[model samples]
Target chain A: MKNAYLNFAQMITGIMVAVLLFIHIAVQKLGVILSFLGFKISDPLAFNSMMERARQGLWAGIYICLLAFGLFHALNGLRNILLETGLSPAKMRTLTWLIIIFGLIFFALGTYVPLVLLTT
Target chain B: MADNRPRENSLGIAGWVWAGNYTLERYLYLLHRVTGLGLILFGIFHLTATTIFRVQGEAVWNATMEFLNNPVFMVGEFLVVTAFAFHALNGLRLILQELGFTLGKPVPPIYPFKDAIRRKRLWTLVTLAAVMVLVVFFFIDFAAGGPG
Candidate 1:
């Protein structure tokens, strides 16, 4: 893709990740704060709690979306950083391909856990 | 293939750090890039550890989680929260500016230039305040650690 389109996607995915991550962090990390504010909750990081969340299809969908957006935004940002290092075109292409492959493998691994939990 | 481009102008990765005594925006630019790389590294580690441990079933996964309950990991988690707070807000500012939403009409080049910094000072302050608020929240939540 052209740089313009890539940047546009980066911006869009950034916004999406920000929104989705707010949800993820609030649920996973701020359980104590939420409970303090009168929400009935427990240790969200506990195995049972995490498994319960993973069992839900909605949670799986959210996790999948977060994973996709987060991975792209992150890896692309890394690419941009590396590109600014005055790399040659051939080197840049190689780095881009490497980043894409790494992202794909990470995404496949990440998606599996939630999918398995939701399906099983 | 020896590609000899003019390298004098290119600061390369060094430009991202210790280039000069830059303005607030420039400093934020450095912070943005650094925090971005940091977050990506953290994501890689977190994903790999969780994936490897998780595929082994609940006992193994729980054991890994137990391992992460140490003070070192707790500190790392807190840092992630702090970094996310800064990166997200600064990124919002960057998005708005890049989209030309925050910038007014282009005035002719004149003396006593009212630069973009002046135009964006409000946004910069707002972003910083928001980040500070989030850091405070993270500090509290970290101390509490899920239902304290």
Candidate 2:
């Protein structure tokens, strides 16, 4: 049952990652297109511009969603990789908890910055 | 009973890339794993970097971005883009398979695998071609002094 649940989660999150990532990349590409059309947006890496963009509702929401999906997909995928390496079941169980803890910490850290930026 | 030696694990750390006689599907699997790991590492670095803006100030964050303007970092950015491309494409392929869309239905053992492979092969090529197009654009941009 645990394995089944994990598989289901992987499938759902994998789809989310694909969709969100494509949207992210398409937005970047759109920037280039806009640049070519003589609408020179500020440097995307500029701190001010990033903060301004984060303040906007759509971009902020997309980023928060990306953060959630990206963390779950990557950490769960990492756990899957580790399990495939012939670890004992006991070690696998321990590693699973470690991954969950670490993933939550990183997710919190990641989400906090965006939330703060979006609100302020 | 004949003494049967344990078979070597070709997918071991050192051998995962170069040890196996791989089909295209196997190669795709390897690339997916490699790119996935690379992107995850980059994500960690990116999260840490972005956290600087919140923890430090805008000045520090700007300083970090300025530091990343170096040529070496530009090259790293290019590789990150490549990794993202592959990981995203192969991830789509995996998702399709998981959803029972591209893997084909179950059948008898006679040439059973070919149907599944045939169904997915076109998509694999299409995704690879899309990545190549993105790579070309990235290379052109990098050559034009863009940060990729």
Candidate 3:
């Protein structure tokens, strides 16, 4: 089975998340440098509101990528953990089905919410 | 000297507790759940908040932000951040583990702390450093009004 390969994919997805986090940190640092130069930036909400505008574009993409990989990765990981703990094969199959169903629901919501906002 | 050992803490609760061999997989599994659940909750909140903004408009977004920024909520925010750190870093470790290499087999009395202390220390230090950078950036971006 290609079950093992699934893990490889998850790892790749994780690396992507790390890169996105780095970008977020970099942007924050840039903001700090600007303020240090005598900008009258004091209100955090104002800061965040401005950040959100830029972040909305950035995070929208990041979250979508995470959702794509994490849904499968997490569900599969959960299944493997359960199987390792000695669940019967028949039971494991049923459990996997349930996880898949729930995962799809969450996945749909995740995709829908972001697309809705970006579109509107 | 007779081998009448002092029960060796065996055939009792202690024995039951220490019955099975330990595996690297178990620790990886636990860490995965910890990270997965953290990320899942973060995802839910992020999505729900956005959906609310779509349905209820700016008023709801303001309310949600206000609640999140409250003193009590600030503590929860810290927890969320910590959870994300654990999830993101540990997830990376789990990924490395999945590279088809058996970290050797399970060892009895899986003293992960004693055995993996150096590796753990390395990972912890990296995680801490990452957190520091994140905090510095957050301060500049959010506190110093650099977001704009």
lDDT of each: 0.84, 0.75, 0.58
Candidate 2 clashes between residue pairs 3 or more apart in a chain or in different chains: none
Candidate 2 chain A lDDT trough over 10 residues, lowest sum = A25-34
Q: What is the lDDT of candidate 3?
A: 0.58
Error of 3 at A102 (Å): 2.1
Per residue, candidate 1 scores C-alpha lDDT tens digits across A1-120 of 377799999999999999999888888778767777887677776677877888899998998999999999999898876766677888888989999999999999999977887866
- Binned by DockQ into CAPRI classes (incorrect, acceptable, medium, high), candidate 1 is medium
Q: Please state the error at residue A54 of candidate 1 in Å.
A: 0.6
Stretches of candidate 2 above 4 Å error? A26-30, A37-40, B1-11, B18-20, B103-115
Model 1 residue B85 CA deviation (Å) reads: 0.7
Query: What is the DockQ for all candidates, taken in turn?
Result: 0.51, 0.33, 0.22
Candidate 1 RMSD to the real structure: 2.8
The clash count of every prediction, one per candidate, is 1, 0, 0
lDDT of 3 at B107: 53
| Cand. 1 TM to true fold | 0.91
Model 2 C-alpha lDDT per residue in residues B1-148, reported as the tens digit of each score: 7523234464677666676566687788888888889989888887888775544768888778777788897788779878887887777777777777876666676754465666678888988998899777766656665522
Collision pairs in model 3: none
